[model samples]
Target: MHPSLTIRRENGDMVKDMPRVKLALVIDDSRVVRKVARRILEDLDFEVAEAGDGAEGLAWCRTEMPDAVLLDWNMPVMDGLEFLQRLRQEPGGDAPRVVFCSVENDLDRVRSALDAGADEYIMKPFDGDIVASKLTLAGVL
Candidate 1:
């Protein structure tokens, strides 16, 4: 396991058991976008992780098993559509619900993402409130 990664089990017997933080993995090529998304999720009390591309995101998901994923449509080394398709094929209840975040607002793109198994979609330049509302709609908040 990577030294930077930590996974804590929720012990039922513990008196002060902290509610498992709703882990959210933000996958985007742009650092700024990832930072913004992380800030929004953090504001909602979620633990956030970031990946620079879809490949790294997939690797993280395999180990971290976050509760939700915020995926960017355009990225190097596996785009969001490909990631979503591959993720749906993985076996386990740990599969995180995914929301595609992108500047692509065309109907075809939206339809494609939905067809590829994304739970929701959000356009770029989004506000924290918008992200929260989308998460709420997706039942992740």
Candidate 2:
């Protein structure tokens, strides 16, 4: 279940309120994959955005950063690793939790992504449960 926060009103009255829906950026070249990820993220109460490639995703982040990024490893313009590296260099980029969602299962690649500031990793063909678990592990859920 999603967690709520207790906030104080202007009059000093305390109330329990649902947290703001987190924004999640889904970056992938495949329309089908993007659609599937959008559905899953929405089900988890995240406001979803889509990008066709890493370059597009980075452009979006530059404008308004999302709370979490569901990133794909391979694409036409820029790959996920390059995007991740460039993102971490941007102002406020470190604030978002990055989860690598990809089909690349190479040990070195995983290590490289984690080394490059990815908070978590999820293999491709992910289900809701897997996505949820990965997000939770990344401290975004």
**lDDT per residue (tens digit) for residues 45-127 in model 1:** 87778889888988887776777899999999999888888777766523587889999999899998987788889988799
Instruction: List residue ranges in candidate 1 displaced over 4 A.
Output: 1-18
Expressed as tens digits, the lDDT of each residue in 1-141 for candidate 2 is 225644333356765655666778899999999999989998998877789999999998987788899999999999999999999999998999999999999989899999999999988889999999999999999
Clash pairs (backbone) in predicted model 2:
none
After superposing candidate 2 on the true structure, give the runs of residues whose Cα lies further than 4 Å from its correct spot.
1-19
Error of 1 at 111 (Å): 1.0
User: TM-score for model 1?
Assistant: 0.85
**Residue range with the least summed lDDT across 10 consecutive positions in model 1:** 9-18
Task: Give Cα distance to truth, residue 40, candidate 1, Å.
Answer: 0.7
lDDT per model vs. reference: 0.81, 0.88
RMSD in angstroms between candidate 2 and the native structure over all alpha carbons = 7.9
